[model samples]
Target chain A: MQFPSLEYLIFFPLAVAAWYAAAPRLRWAVLIGAGAAFLALASPTHFAFAFVLSLVNYFAGLALERWAETRKALWVLLATLAFDVGVLGLFKYGNAVLAGFAQLEALFGVAAPPRVLSLVLPLGISYYSFQLIGYLLEVYWGRQPAARHLGHFAATILFFPKLVAGPIERPHHFLAQLAAPKPFDPADVTAGLKLLGWGLFKKCVIADRIAFVIGPIFGHPRDFSGLPLAAAIALYTVQVYCDFSGYTDVALGSARVLGLELAPNFNHPFSARSVTDFWRRWHISLSSWTNDYIYRPLSMVISFHTSWRRVGTVFSILVTFGVLGLWHGATWNFVLFGLLHGAAVSVEALTSRARTRLLGRLPARVADRLNNVVTVVFYSLSCVLFRANSISDALYILGHAFVGIGHAAPIGAKRMFGRQYHILLLGLVFGALVLGRWWTRRRPVAARPTWQRWPVYYAVIAAIVILGLFQVNQFVYVQF
Target chain B: MTPEAILLEVNKVFAEVFGNPSITVGPTTTAKDVPEWDSLNHTALIAAVEKHFQIKFSLREVMRFQNVGDMCALVRAKTGG
Candidate 1:
């Protein structure tokens, strides 16, 4: 169930009650059980598959750690990845492959048949699969110890709040909390609730509201033109950020309520001055994951080979982002989304060096401002690929949005504002996001007192009640 | 190279890239210990290490590193000190 759902709204409190009531030793089991049952609401059959997969990874990690020989551990690690990928491939990408084959057969004028299976995706498979893989790799390499208790290990993989969609908790970061007994902290509970409320405001109010304008245009991009398309793309930027970050807030907050702190998934992404900055801010968990697992590894290949270092960096960026894009879904649009970002990041890296030199030659502030503007525009353009349903549709939106800028049709000022109140609110949200980020940076979340935090909580709730759309669409990232 | 010597160079790189001349190098020191050791800066650190020691690190070696001590050990292994 989506974290913002009314059912989850009620479910969390009751679970919290039972959670704190249980003995410290049994608390992990209670949380895991509640989480597994919660997951069953999406698809009961898939839940079993999830359980089995969790067990496989859990045991594999332990075995990898126990094996004294490096070569033997490497074998176990490779086998585990292959098995996990095989299962993920069958469930997630199997349909796209089948469809691709059918079209190929049609091109050749032959009967191309489709394979049918229930093939329902379990909630958070993409997230948990990645988390599990990270755990295994860490253990195999001796970065983290394998949990002796199977239950604790399972709980780590299936922690309810962040299970389906996640901030992608790491083994070292999260497992220790599960093993230790946590004292009840009223402050943590209050803080977690405030975080939850802020998340709801983001999802229900800002994101959902923006989606109102964005959904229509994206649903049928052809019908709209000029200002509406541009407005829609801009709105989508808010919609996606609020939607995903909103979920992250609730996830992190709920886990906090349980006295388990998850990593922050987003910083102020919209305020980013460059595509590189954007990656730093956006989906921080995933971005950092790719950095560590994919990008760093690839960079090493180049670093070790002096001759291939430059080529390695380029190849790694392309392959890392390509995998990252495809990880979102098995679509050509997603591929382009990955490539576009990759290209932008490469450009940003190259320009940053040039920019440093240019700064010495020109007005630093002006160059910085110009760089920021160019970065925002590049980011918004790349997002067209991220938001569109197909490659052609993305091209259409990009082409028309930029085509004859300020010349095509004068967007009716009144009508535009009337239709997209959130568009106007975008300025406010962006403004608040900037201020809030600055404030948070100045004072860390841990330093804030209970009373000082209440205003932020109340404001978020007020935003939800007054502005939230309340029409739940599947979170964009949930499909992955 | 002794562990101390390797650590001195590691600390020098950390100090230069992160601009925290006071940052101490220890076996347990991690990114959390120094706020500026972020992903982007992480790349800078590895790049700096390669340039400093003239030793290449495989991706596996770089990713598997946990702390300053581990990184020093990896550099030593590669340089055959």
Candidate 2:
């Protein structure tokens, strides 16, 4: 169910209540049942898909553990990984491949093939598949033991909170929490509620409001001129951050309320001063996963072939990010998005020493501001590919972004904030952005004195109530 | 093959790979402890160590090293010290 919907509003409280009411030993059963119910409620097809994959991976993990240190274990690991990737490919890319084949047939004047079985993408397939693949690899490499309990293993893959869109919990971290579920703590509950509220405010107030303006400009980029286009791109950058990170906050907070800890995903990414630093902070879990599983191993292999280590590192970064981009979807634009980032990161790595030397010559504050501006502009421009309808469209917009600067009319804020409250809303958004940066720099808000924190909390709640769109817009990351 | 002996070689590799002659690493030193020891430089350091010590590390072995101490232990074990 969508996070902001009435159904989820009712379902979450009931699920939480039932979970706590159960005996500690049976809590796992409660979680498993709840997860199954959620999947079934969402889609029986998704429920079947998740269940089958979980069962397959469960046995695969055991077999890998049983045959560890043998050639058989290697085969088991490869087989399980293939199955996971195969399932993901068939469900996620099956339609895209079909469409591509149709275009090829038209080009060659060949008869089209008959219709294939239509596939519905199982929710969380990309995320859970990666989790299972990581689990199998860990077991094969003897990094972590295969989970003995089938229920816990299934729960790890199908846990409802993070299943939809993830911080992509690793086996080592997530399984440990499942092994010993904690009892309800009042402080945990309070902290979780605060985080949940903040996340909701970000989603409903900031992201959804921004989407109203972003939709038209990006949808018809040819119609708008320089400033409006730039504003759309910049707003899109903020909107995506709020939407995805807002989802993560709610997921983490909900898990915390249940006394489980999910891995953190975002880390104030906009504060990053360089492209490399941006990757370090943004979508932290996914980047780390790719770093460990894809980039590091690929770099090692590349190192065997190349004498110049920098070339190998740069090549590996590009390939790894290319794959990461493809992970977003089976689209050419996504591929470009990933490659752009890859190139940017490679440049940053290659020029680190030179950049450091240059920065050393400047004042610290000047250097910091310059770096931040460069990073932000580079990333915002790259996101043009991410948000555009096609690569050509993205290029057109990028080509025109700075063309008519200072000559165009201000992109009015009426559609985004309503005619009466445009100025007020704009001021609030700007204020929130500034305060968000300052707040993140401090300790966790939950840890602050109530006298200091309550006012901020109430203000956020009030803002959300006054300005929230309350539309059922799925988070941008969910499609991935 | 002793930890101390391996660490001396490791320290040299670190200095050469990172281009900092003053650099020194002990058993407990981690990546975070060194300013220049980022992901790109890390692979180079591993390669330099392997070439110097005449021991190749498995991918898992390379990934599992948490600190210089772990690397020293692996080197010692592989060299049959």
Q: What TM-score should be assigned to candidate 1?
A: 0.86
Worst 10 residues of 1 chain A by lDDT: A406-415
User: What is candidate 2's CA lDDT for residue A120?
Assistant: 78
* lDDT for each candidate structure: 0.78, 0.83
Top candidate (lDDT): 2
By TM-score, the best candidate is 2
Chain A only: TM-score per candidate: 0.89, 0.92
Per-residue lDDT of candidate 2, residues A1-480 (tens digit): 777667778878888898789887667677778788877888888878888998999899899889877889888888888899999999888888888888888899988775565877899888888888877877776778889988888888888888889988896687788777788899888888778887888898888877765676677777666777777788888888899999999889888888889999988788789988899899888888888788887898777666868889999999989988999999999999999899999998899889899899999999998998999889888989998999988997898878767223334333333533643585678887788769868686657898977887898888778877775578888889
lDDT of 1 by residue, A163-241 (tens): 8778777856777887785889998898898788888888887787677656657767776667778877777876788
Query: Candidate 1: where are CA atoms >4 Å away?
Result: A107-109, A302-306, A362-364, A404-459, B7-60, B76-81
